[model samples]
Target: MMSDVLKNCHHRWKTLNQRWSLQTRLLYINMLLVGLMALGISVAYYTLTRYDKKQQSRERLNIAFKIMQDDFQERL
Candidate 1:
């Protein structure tokens, strides 16, 4: 009787182990996806910020050039 009980217990343990391993794999896959998403978002944010700064710099440079042109014309 004891041997039969031990066999049943062993079988149950094997089933539980398989389920645990599957769950662990799924968790790892989910973590990887989340990491990728975070990286993509970070890159996009940086690009947008850089573009905005470039636009502002261009506007400032144009204004400065216009001022210089006007000043030179007045002197002439």
Candidate 2:
């Protein structure tokens, strides 16, 4: 009877260990997904910021061109 009980206990321990390992694996996967999402968002934000800066620079250049043209016309 004691041997039977010991065997059952051992089996239960193994089963519990397997369950815990699976849980850990799932947790790692979830963390990976979150990390990927954060990276993607960061990349998108940076891209948008760069695009906005480029657009502002273009607008400033256009204004400068207009001023230079007006000045040249006045001198002529």
- In order, candidate lDDTs are 0.96, 0.96
TM-score of each: 0.68, 0.69
Q: Which 10 residues in a row give candidate 1 its minimum summed lDDT?
A: 16-25
- Alpha-carbon runs more than 4 Å astray in model 1: 1-20
Write candidate 1's Cα lDDT for 1-76 as tens digits. Answer: 9999999999999887787877797898999999999999999999999999999999999999999999999999
* Top candidate (TM-score): 2
Please give, for residues 1-76, the per-residue lDDT of candidate 2 as tens digits: 9999999999999897777877797898999999999999999999999999999999999999999999999999
RMSD of each: 10.5, 10.7
Kindly state the number of residue pairs that clash in model 1.
0
TM-score of 1: 0.68
Model 2: CA > 4 A from native: 1-20
Report clash pairs, candidate 1: none
